[model samples]
Structure formats: C-alpha cells, structure tokens
Target chain A: MRVITGREAVREALREEMQRDENVFIIGEDVGVYGGAFGVTGNLIEEFGEERVRDTPISEAAIAGAAVGASLLGMRPVAEIMFMDFVTIASDQLMNQGAKIHYMFGGQQNAPFVMRMPAGAAEAGAQHTQSLEALLYHIPGLKVVMPSTPYDLKGLLKTAIRDDNPVMFVEHKKGYGEKGEVPEEEYTIPFGKADIKREGKDVTIIATSHMVFKALNAAETLAEKGVDAEVLDPRTLVPLDMESIVKSVSKTGKVVIVHEAPRRGGVGGDIAARISDSEAFYYLEKPIKRVTGPNTPVPFSPVLEAEFIPSEEKIIDAVMKLTK
Target chain B: MELSEAKKLKMYRDMWRIRQFERKVDQFISRGDITGTTHLYIGEEATAVGAINALKDEDYISSTHRGHGHAIAKGSDIKEMMAELFGKRTGACKGKGGSLHIIDTSTNNLGANGIVGGGIPIAVGAALALKMQNRDEVVLNFFGDGAMNQGAFHEATNLAAAWNLPVVFLCENNQYGMSTSIEKAFKIKDLAKRGEAYGIPGVRVDGNKALEVYDTVLEAAKKARNGGGPSLIVSETYRWKGHSKSDAKVYRTKEEEEEWKQRDPIADFEQILIEQNLLDEDKIKEIKNEVDAEVKEAVEFAKESPYPDKDEIFDDVYVDREVEL
Candidate 1:
C-alpha cells in the first residue's frame, strides 16, 4: 500500500513499535540529537523525547550491557550498533550474556530486546563492510534476521521488537536505499519462512539480504539462457525454512545456496548440508553449488571488496555448471 | 553497641547459618557429591551476612562467582541452590546453572556471573530500572578487589555515579583475587581510593567484624534509599580456602592463612554474642546445629532429585518460536 525505501521502513518499524509499547525504548550512539548513523532514527528523539530515544556514549559493551540489564527488568530495549563490525567490542555482552541468559536461567528470564546493526558491503572498507550474520546464527537462543525488501524489513523488524528472545537484526547498508512497495497499513513477516521471489524449476536458488537482489538479477539472466531458477529468500537464519529449500530442491533436483558472508563455514554450507540430509537428495540431478565470498577478510579496494562478496556473474556461472 | 538485642541476635543467627552452609558445601564438594568448582566463603561470612542484613527483602543484589554465601544471605532457598549445584531438574535454573549461576528472582537475588566484573553493569542497570520505575529499592553490587581493574567495573561505576542511581557498590576485597594478592594488582594499597575517582564517597571497613560491615552497609543503604546516590564500601576480608576447589593455596604461607583464621568472622561474632550476653554458648550451638541440619536436608533433597531431561536444552530458549512465512 505504501512505497518506501528500506531505510524508511526500518524507521517506521522503530517509531511504530516505540509508540505501541511503553516499555520499549531505543538506545545507541547518535540515536538522539544527531539521529542514527544511517538516519533511520532521524527526528525520533524529538518525537519520543530523550528518555525514550537515548543517545549513549561510544561504549558497545555499556550499550549492550545496559540493554541486557534493562531487558531483564521487563523493558523491551532496541540497541543499535552503528556498524556490524563494531559488535565485536560488545560480543561478551551479546554472546556470553545476552544469548545465554534465558537458557542459563532455565526460563526464569528472557532478554526481550533487539540489536540493530548496519551490515554488508557498500563503500565502507574491510572492517565496516563485513556481514557477520553467520557468526550470530551459530549462537543458540538468538534469532538472526536479514530482510531484503522494505515490506519484509518493516514487518520483520516489528516482529523482532515484540519477540521475547534477543534478536540480532542485521540490515544491509546498500539495501536501505533500495525502493520497495511497503504496505501503508501495518504488517509483520514471520520468521523461518522463505519467500519465493520468482518461482522456477531448473534450480533452487536460496539467498538472503542483498544476495536476494543479485539472485533475482541472475534469475532473469538465467531465463534468457533457458535455465529457469526458483529464487528463495529466507529472511531469518536461525529458524531457517528448510522445508521450502527441501521442497524446491525436490522439484528442481539441483540447488545453489548464496550468501554475502565468507564461504568457509558460511550459512550456504549449512543449507547445502540440510538439503543433502533431507529426502530431497533422491531428486537431485546434480550436486548442490554454494556461491559465497572467499575465505578472507573483506578487502579495502572497491574492486577486491566487490570480489569478496558473491556476485550475480558467479551465480550465473554456478547455475550453468549445474544446469549443464 | 547501642543496637537492640533482637537485631544483634538476628545478625548472629544469619552469620551462623552462612558459616554452617559454606562448611557443609565444602564437605559435600570435597566428597564429590556436588559436581564442579565450588568457591567457599568460609572466612568471609561477615561480609555477606552483614551487608545483606543491611538490605531489605525487596532490595536487589548482584553476586559474584563465590556467591553461595550472598545468595543464602539474600534469602535464596537452600534446597533449590543445593539441587542446582547437584544439577537436578528442580534446581533454581532447572540444573542448567550450577554453583556459579544460582539465582532467585523472587528474592531479587540476581544470578551469579561467571565472568569477573560482569555483574557490575547489570547491577547499575537494575538500579537504573529502579530509578525509572520510581521505586525506593536500592541495589547492592558485590564484587572483589580484582574486579576493580576490570573495564566493566570502571564503566559501571562511572555510569552509576553519573546517573546518581540508588546502588551500593560493595567491594568485598577479600585479600586476594584467586592467588594474586590485591597488593600486587594495584599500586595503591587502599582499594577505596579507586571509588573516589568516580566522585562517590568510599568507605573502608573491617571485613572481619559483622557489626562494622552491618553498620557501614546500613548507612550506605539508607543514603541510597534517600536518593543520596551510590557509594562504594570496600570491606577488607580474607578467604579461608583457595580461590576454587582445586587451589592448593600456593601463593600465601600457612602463617598468613592461620593469622586470618584467628580473626574468623564466625568466631568473632560468637565472641561478640558471648560478651554482650545477647546469645549464650548453648543458644549459639543450637543455631549452628539447626543450620547444619538444614544444610544436610538440602543435600539429601538434591541427591534425591532427578537430572533434567535431555530435550530440555531445546526448550526454554525463548517464550515463543512461531513458524512465520
């Protein structure tokens, strides 16, 4: 019903959720007064006041630690990490404490919170460009979500806000500016459900975040080459939609898992393994292919950095190898 | 000296309970009945009992890894704690959290953290919660001397001081952090000075004396409740045993241990009780026996309790995990 960029969708999600719940508040560096680093929280401080939209000192540990502590006391806190790379500074609070609290306490408490970080490669060099969704997904008791479209971003972010468990919601920096038709009315996308962007039968192309766009682009190119590819975008990584992948793999009899993260120990490997383990293996006419970044740090140079992330050309090459 | 006889007697009883409980846990852990590393609070009973006694039932306390004494002092169920240490299904955290993670939210006793200085920020946050809620309750963050050097300690202290939150940062400087002496960790011998940097009043108290710690905490708690902001009470105490169950006490000599043992908190309290004629020897012995029996009953209950089911690992991760498309 509405046409908005991914950034606007995220801003709307935070605003709506903050307005809906009294206990909910946003805290991060430059969130208030200066607005968020990505401008997603622009003018929110004026709207919600400084109490609800707080700007914190540059302490990831403190921000995350306070959020965890606040969440423990029945507050729904949404913390922002300016870049996904900086989350390393607060990994202790995130992985050791936040992720373990609910399970360690044996259900006595839950860290009902959301951590928003701008992830993926754009112009930012090696450190800022890395997408570490796979690392977070590896941890238990955490919901890791990456939304591709504005509609999914809005709905899924709202869902993450209300979720009782801690959610690591990673937004691609480049995807934020991408325009999409988001509903004027409110909506929420469920976790672990795969969205089939364009259904085909030649190969099951599973992607996430920015890679969804690339996969769709590759799908169009593959159509010209007479190779129909079914593109599936799984918004969440933790509660992954294995059924959708398995079903598509069953029909297509070939698969390609694509992600922006490094190929070594990447989510693509996990998806490929699941497909192999599932009953869909019998239908496989060709072995599964995984299109991922190389096992190295994201490069500083734009050309090398672009190579570090998966590309549509590589997807096309992998698809041609499988389709042949 | 002007404290009521009832108050004096109650302090003696709680201190006796903590001493008895720690001793029993030591024996149980040594006998292999209780699994995992146990941090005994044998010599530092006064620090926990006295400081905790100063707090109200609703007041929150963030505990350290050597937290059994603090937990017991904060009114956590001994039975559940014992069961948890035994890794039983009916434990405080359903046996997932062992000796170090025992927590009872009902009693406002936050979970003991494994990482050193981890609970400081949590305590500060809890105090901030109280402030936001406009509640009169105060938070007592219990840490050791070694935690003073941790980044979390500095960050938490600075934040608490800046916010003027209702919290008492009770540093139980028990001579050593594991085997490393506090003297070796810092240039200044005085631990209270570290708190002064944060612009809050810091007090150095005799950790061996229950009355001293009790009075100090009473003042701090009162100040916090009255919106006077946070204070640091560095209680200089000593641990009777090594840092953990496996420690051989290689760092300190037998003489050093013996010297501190002479000023034993329980013995010191017992002497006070006798001198004041508040509790006779027979009454003290009766209290000790009652504590011993209670500890024994908890051990029995833990031994009888069943281990948690294997499938429980997947459960309790979150409140809900609905499949969404």
Candidate 2:
C-alpha cells in the first residue's frame, strides 16, 4: 500500500491506462507541458510524449468534438475541461452527440470516451464553483462517477477507463490534495457498488463525493453522543447501488440522503423515492430526510458558501432530530 | 487541368440524381410515407454533386440537415438512404435517424447533423485523426451560409489552419437559413472571405455551374490531400423548395425565385454536356431514364424494409457487454 493524494491517484490512473493502451490519450487545455490546472496530470507529457498528452487550444467544443471523432475512429480519449463551468461550451457535443450517438444510431457504434470535469464549490463564485453533475446525471447514456477519496478515485478511474461507454467522471476540486492509502497494484472497483464507510443501528446516511467526507465526520460526532450512524458512499450516481441503500435503511429504520448539489431534482430525491417504493419502506420508523445545497448558485463568499454546502453540523442536527 | 468529357458528363448525371431523389423524398414526405419533415436539396443539387465528385471514394465528407444530396454524391446506396429518410428498419441508421440524420459509416459520410455549424469541428476532428495516422484522406464538411456566423465555424477553421489538418469547408450558400436570408444573417457579402481571418485560401464560385464548382473544389480537395491544410469554398447556390415542406416562400420575392430557377443546375449541366458534344440526345434521355428507375427502386426498397425488433434497442449502447465506455 502507498499513501497518495486524489491528484496522484488520477495521475497514476492516466499513466497506467496510457501504458496499457496506446489508443488511450488525454487532450485538454493546460493538460500538457503546463500540467493540468489542478496538477492531476502533472509531468505526464514528459513520460508519455506530446502526442499522447495533447494540449489543445482553448476551444472546449473543438476539444470535445475531436475526442468524439477520435473515439469513433478507434481511440480512447479522456478530455479534461478545466472547470465544470467550461462544460457548458461543449454541451452540444456532450449532451446532443456523445449522450445520444449510441441510442440514435440504434446501437451500431460505441462512444468509448471519458470526460473529466473538476467540479463542486470552492468559494469560487457562481460560474466556477457550481456542482453540475445533476445536469449530466439527467442525461441518458452517460455514466456519472464521483470519487471522494484517493483510493476510490484510483479504483474508479481504472474502472471508468476500461469501461466501453461514455463516462462523465467528475472530480471535486477540493478533494484533490486530500491523502488516503491506495494499494500499489492495478484493480478496478465495480461501479454501482456503494461502500459502507461505517456501520450503525440508528440512522443510514447515503452520501456522494465530498459529502461522504462530511458524513463520516458527522458519524464520528454522532458516536460521541451515543448515536451510531451508518455512512454509505455511492461512488457512482448513474447506476446507483439502490439495493445497498435499501438494505442499510431496512436495518437502521431511518435514512438521510446527502449531496452537494441543490435539493431540487438532486440524486437524493431519487434515492428517497426508491426506498419509499421498495420493501424497505415497511421498516422505516421515520420519513427519509435529504440534506443538500440550497436551491441557488454557489456563492463567492466563504461564509455564505459554507451555509450553501452541507456540513458536519448540519448532518449532526438532522441526525439529532431523527434520534430525538 | 480540365475535367475529361466522361467525368463532366458523369457529374451531370449525379446532380440529376440528387434533384430527382429530393423531389421524390418531398413527395413521399407529403404523402406521409415518410413520417417527419424534410429539407429538400432539389435546388442545390449541383453544389453537392460538383463538390463531392471532385473527391475519391476514400475521402470523407460531413453533411447537414439538407444532406440527401451529399450522401448520394458520396456514393451511399440510394435504396438504404431512402429507407433511412423514411425511418424504415432497413434504413441507413436502421430507422433511428429519419430524414435529418442519415448516417452510412460504409461510405464515410459521418452522418448529417441537425444543428447548425455542428459538423465543422467534427470534420476538423476526422482530418486530425487522418493527419495523426499519416493518411492521405481529406475531409469535406458541408454547411449552409447561416452556419458561417456560428463560433464553431470560426474556431474550427482557425484550429484546422493552425495544425494544417487536411479538410475542405464547403459552404452551400443557398441564400436562406430556414426563413432567415443570408443578407440579414451575415454582414460579410462573400462567405468565403471569412476564411481570410484564419490565413487560409478562400474561393467564391457559381454553384450552379457543375464544371466550375467541380474544378475549384477539386483543386481545394487536392491541396488538402497533399497536406496543404484547409480551404473554404463558398458555392453560391439556391434551394428549389421551401426550407422544409412546411415553409412558404414568404421571405424572398417571386421574381428572385424565378431568376434563380433560370440557373437550374441540372438543366444547365445537361445543356453543357450536349453543347460540348459529350452526350448525344439519345444518351441524355437514356441517363434520365436510368436515374428515374433507380429512384423508384429505392423508394420501393424503403417501403418494403422491416422495422427493427424491440430487443435490438438495448444491443449497441456499449461496445462491450459488461462495461460502459
């Protein structure tokens, strides 16, 4: 085992994937000699050469379209849009073409492309800080994965690279430098399998991305107060591990789904509905709770932004309400 | 550098095929044999035929909503194309892409796009792949005059020029984008001049003249194949029908319509072939008969093709069965 940051995990995945497959190359702005904007791809071009680590012009549409075309002609291209906001410019290629090519063509062609967008709030204001994974999650034919830890990032990134369908692998910018122990061997984590971070009998906390960290912290706080909270981290949102969530909720008799995206139409609502509609609903003692960001743009100010994202205090409050 | 008599004659026949096929498609759409609306390429036949005829079979091309002409010119089978437009099970896209989205990977047509300026970057991408693979194949991307105003066009051209990717941007300036006239849509009088900003050669030509458009576009295609980078060729053409079957000629004057009609590409090419002594009247009549019979057969094939099975819907979502791409 080796200690690696989320950024290093990403870099290792790129290196390993590029080494295993010649057709796999990365193209994006500032992804080459300048490294990535977040340093996830630092020093990769030196190891792989300029051809494999392509630094493209600041044209998101062109970069995305080129990836799609190259994918069509037998290339596994991973495109990194500097910020999640920049994905708007390439929405046509991603939503219209990338997401619909297989279905529209009646399954004749496979769009084996991965678009990595560094998303989530960092007090960077309305545009740069928005966690827009919900927008992509709404689109069909796209697999959405968000890894909160270094080990999960490495494992999931490997799975995403080997997967033969188009994937939107979103990375929270704040989670990049966070370190965790990752095994020094090649292994891919199966998608749609939720990890039970902590087991408890009081409440089931289903969270994603950075919210997983928040949930784990909240669990620690709850433990001090004699409340054992079960924390579940769903690495992927598209092919959600609803079974695991339902099973956990069944044992605990209460659940709270948490995410950083706005509460309206967030993944939490879907999880809540799944639990309510399933056999797990009979065991529930209280209504399922959903803790999410406010229904507004991410604020630039640190104080307001803190209020916007779900925090340990908020999770503790919600858990206390259910336990009381 | 002149096109041979046989090639020029062949080009004329191809333009006629587009005209007749489009007219038939319009009729089929009106009769409800085809479910959706269609953008006819009847008036702009010469532009697609003239430009695509300059390319070899291995060369690539991207088309727009008004794309049947380009598909036929690039050698897509008329039967499968007709079925595709009709949304039949045996259609080029297996009934998934009706009318505006006919795609045939076999001919390297790269599918027609529904969005304006959508194919520009795709063409550039294909060219980039070709350059990286050290292939001599050139990509021809066709769009309308209205698409010239889109940012994708400017960005794609700039990137293509910077990297010296092998591509030719063929703009079929048929006067209007839907109901919006090019005069109202753009400030630049000559669409080809837009390429000057990217430091590439640009040419404006009479799209109705098959030989002229063919020769000019042939030169551009040759330059691309030889690694001379991208060129923008603006073909001044006209659409014979409304933008789609739903449109009425409310935007332009009837006199303007009559004036463009007088320059009918098929008629003009037929006269050129005859006056140049490339074809006798009997041979011209025979070619017309052959084109008509072929179109009829295509419509019949589309009518007879079966719809896809329900289970087929889940088949091609991912290349591999267990993993998503």
Predictions in order: lDDT: 0.87, 0.86
Alpha carbon deviation, residue A205, candidate 2 (Å)? 1.5
Task: Give each candidate's interface RMSD in Å.
Answer: 2.1, 2.4
What is the CA-based DockQ of model 1? 0.55
Off by over 4 Å in 2: B1-6, B309-325
For A19-55, candidate 1 gives per-residue lDDT tens digits of 8998888988899988898888999998999878877
Supply the global lDDT for candidate 2: 0.86
Which lDDT value does model 1 have at A185? 82
Clashing pairs in 2: A107-B316, A163-B324, A164-B324, A164-B325, A165-B324, A165-B325
Model 2 chain A poorest 10 in a row by lDDT: A102-111
Clashes of each: 0, 6
Q: Considering every candidate listed, which one attains the maximal DockQ?
A: 1
Best lDDT among the predictions, by candidate number: 1
User: What does TM-score give for chain A of every model?
Assistant: 0.98, 0.98
Off by over 4 Å in 1: B1-4, B321-325
